[model samples]
Target: MIAVILMLSRGSHSRSHKLKSRALICSVLLWMSTAVMTRSSSTSDLKSKISGVEELLEEFRKQLQQDESGSREDEEDGDRCISGFKAAEERIIRASASIEQGAAFLSAPQRVFSWRDCAHACCSHPHCTAAIIQEDLKQPDDSLRCYLFNCTYRGRSVCSFSFQPGFSTYSRVNNSSRPHEPGRGSTATDSPSLDEPPRSDAGQDLVVQLPTDWAVLDGRDSTDDHDIIHYEWALVKGDPSVKMKVTHPGLLKLSGLREGIYTFELTVTDTSGQKSSDNVSVSVLAPAPNAEGQKLFVYIFLDYF
Candidate 1:
């Protein structure tokens, strides 16, 4: 595939490399235009593109990392803008190289108290753009999950992970696509990774008469995949728990939560070492009025999911 692509590319590496520099300057314009033009890609494809962008950035950092000598700098200085295809090429090269030389596999790190523990690790690691599960050849899905590190141009999967035997059997939890959305990231195509839910605003209403508030306390997903929500929240201005003001997730039976917008969150680190977080806004207010003629009291509540 890459060979075909290379043949189709208009210029030689030298010329292409120079153009790459220009691409960097126009990256913003290109990104916006691309977003408008490529909305047809599936949700998964979009995720892949975003991941690809992050991968390029990470690979770029590693690529630019230098030794004391100036020789390496000169070799890479020619190409600055990261192309999606080039990034893909680098992965192929690294995966291939890993296959030739012995590769060291790493077990997924432990100490994850909850999902958040593992989620943070993946988010922080540059090489670890996506995550996959480590499986026993015989059991596959039944096997334990592990992290999948980003592969390089020279190392193939088998060659790179042969030594450690830990990274050998794994499945990715994040997409490897190009970047589309700057503020959001793909957790995994279908895997139960952490994802911020759409902020719900239905709960806030003037009819609540009495002030109220609401929140997700150790929320669970509908199927435990995208359904559960483990969150930490504070009344940024009022009490750490809740302000006397109205907010979302209004008035819990046990606590004095009230009428206003409220935030909820859940972070998870998968067995594969990939981690993600979900920040959702839930609306809270006095239940809809029994009848229509209620005095509506509008309250401005600040909440972070």
Candidate 2:
């Protein structure tokens, strides 16, 4: 009976050891599964974050491209506007070549605008086929008048335009159907007939006989202000010894003149500091043979008397 009891105790100890071993194996398996699940969750989160960053980067790139394209388009439009207006100015000037001194055409309502503003205004207006800028000599530099016209009118002198000087006209060609009527909405009146003669006293070439001794060269400007007038003379060509002495405003004296063709320039400056120059050609003629014989007789009579 003692041997049977010892054997039963050894069997019970072996079963307990087996059960403890099985529990330790189960705990190890549960720990490993928990670690794998945590690792998988971290990988998925990292991938999702990377995808979000890539999408954001793509969006930013697209926006940058759009901004660059828009900037280029704006620059192109500005260039075209300037070029168009410049072309118009050239065309109008050529068309109004018949007018002397200043150009006059059938113009639209006058608008106070700058060169660039005038260009944009012409582009925007439906009836405006052309544009012109006329500067007021009496007004300051900042004050400029813009005239828009649908049709061009040429063959008018500055006198017909109410003595207004410094008028410039510009035009743009439209391929659309039907051009606007001339003088319909024109603020400027109809110019007088071309048959009318221009003013004789108006600025013209000076033709005079060279003096035998000292010749007084007189230059006159019709400017309203005489106090602010500044006179300048320069010998453009001909005799080098010829000298110009400025006596006063619009007055020059030639002291050392010879018998030859001499070209002299007379520049007049106004109160606004605007300068205008006119070239005068002087012709000096030698004394005639008959004049010397007549002078000798007159001198003999004077001596005898």
Candidate 3:
């Protein structure tokens, strides 16, 4: 009976050892599964963060492109508006000068910073043909009073100069090929026939690459019924150091041009003493960099990123 009890105790001890081994194996498997699930969750979060960064970069690039496009459009519109009109010579008119009839005032005088600003204001109106800018000593700049005019009455062009002191005028050039109509109530035999003022053609605007220091201006296309006795060329606005010379009749030579916009005026006076003027602009651009230098710059820029 003692031998039988010892065998039973050995069997019970063997069963307890097997149960402990099975429990250890199950605990290892549970730990491995938990580790795999944690690793998978970390990878998913990393991928989600990467995707969000890419989306943000794309949105930033699109916003930059939109801003660049808008800026380009605004620049183009400003250039187009400013280049449409021509400025006349500034002259002082005393009380002896008579004001022309049929001058239609467009609106009340507007305060502006410069004559260019006044011209821009006039360009905003559809029927505005001319602008008069009056200088005011109280203002910081010469552009103080701006007067807009239609310069047309009924179907005829009856606009004439009234030249007031401290005032300058700018008129829109007629780009159409049509001729101007005759003046009001003037008969054929009125001593000096009321002829149309000479048309001054300052030629098309020009753009030149730099290192070029000279340019030619031709006003040979200016037209008048009578002989145009005088042709005058003046630098309206630009670098004041530039030199000008009348190389021939209705032709001018400009030298020492810099990388900036230069405006020139061409005035033609006919035998009847009637004068007309037109403006032309020349834009000088800086030279482009060498191709090798550009490529090197691009490479350096990319490596920095």
Candidate 4:
């Protein structure tokens, strides 16, 4: 009986040990699963934050690129303006040459078309085709043939308004009160705006007022002996006027100039001739055909920011 009882007790002990081992194994697997889930959650959160930062950086970079592009476009506009001036100069030269060619036709008989006299004749009639190359006409009977043109001399004077041709007479054009139009001179249609400083236009820029007519800076303040020029400006771009008088009479004066966008720089000079400068910009409303030719000159009050 004792031997049987001892064997039964040993079997019960073995069953208890097996049950404990199974519980320990289950607990270890559950712990490892919890750790893996937490790690995955943390990694996902980190990735999300990194993506947000990248997106913000991309936005900043795009803004920077846009700014650079705008700068390049402004430079291109300046170049185009200069090119327009050059083209206009060429057209004047051609028109002057055509005048000479027409006058040469007039002097076929006596054949002495001085540029001065011929130019005068060509400009007499509003729609005259040719000029009287020579004025020493024998009579009106030969005057018709005197104005005949046949491109003979194509010299450098063809484009030269400065050419000194013998002697001549200048007459009123088209019976108008205005004097004979002088040969076209170079026209500068540049308008400079002097309102807000250039540093103000960052995101959405506001319109700036320009000068009305011509504004001359006599160096010093109109009243004071102070020579330093400081640009303390405000935006009057929405108004229309040639001259804008501010409450501060001794400050600044705006004038009407050509029409166009103008970048104005205030050149500050001391008695020692030391110089400093501040920059601002304004846009004058003008047509696309003449935008490059438009000039706006604005003045800013100095001594304030």
Compare the candidates by TM-score and give the number of the best one: 3
lDDT (10s digit) by residue, model 1, range 158-218: 3232333333222222323122222233333543433322121222222222344433343
lDDT pick, better of 2 and 3: 3
User: How do the residues 22-118 of candidate 4 rate in per-residue lDDT, one tens digit apiece?
Assistant: 5555566577678889999999999999999999999999999999998887555444322221111111112346543432222333333444334
Angstrom error of the Cα, residue 104, model 3: value is 1.5
What global local distance difference test value does model 2 have?
Answer: 0.54
**Segments in model 4 whose C-alpha atoms lie over 4 Å from true places:** 1-13, 82-305
Q: Which of candidates 1 and 2 is the stronger one according to lDDT?
A: 2
Candidate 3 lDDT over residue span 1-305, tens digit each: 34543444455556677576556555766777788899999999999999999999999999999999989876666665566567775742221222234344666455587877887777676456677777788866544888877664333555667545678877766521112222223222343433445667899898878788889999998877567999999888999998899989999988888999999999999898978789999998897778999999999999999
- TM-score result, candidate 1: 0.23
List the lowest-lDDT window of 10 residues for candidate 2: 193-202
lDDT scores in order: 0.37, 0.54, 0.71, 0.38
Evaluated at residue 255, the lDDT of candidate 3 is 89
Clashes of each: 68, 0, 0, 21
Per-model RMSD to reference? 32.7, 16.0, 30.5, 30.9
lDDT for predicted candidate 4 compared with the true structure = 0.38
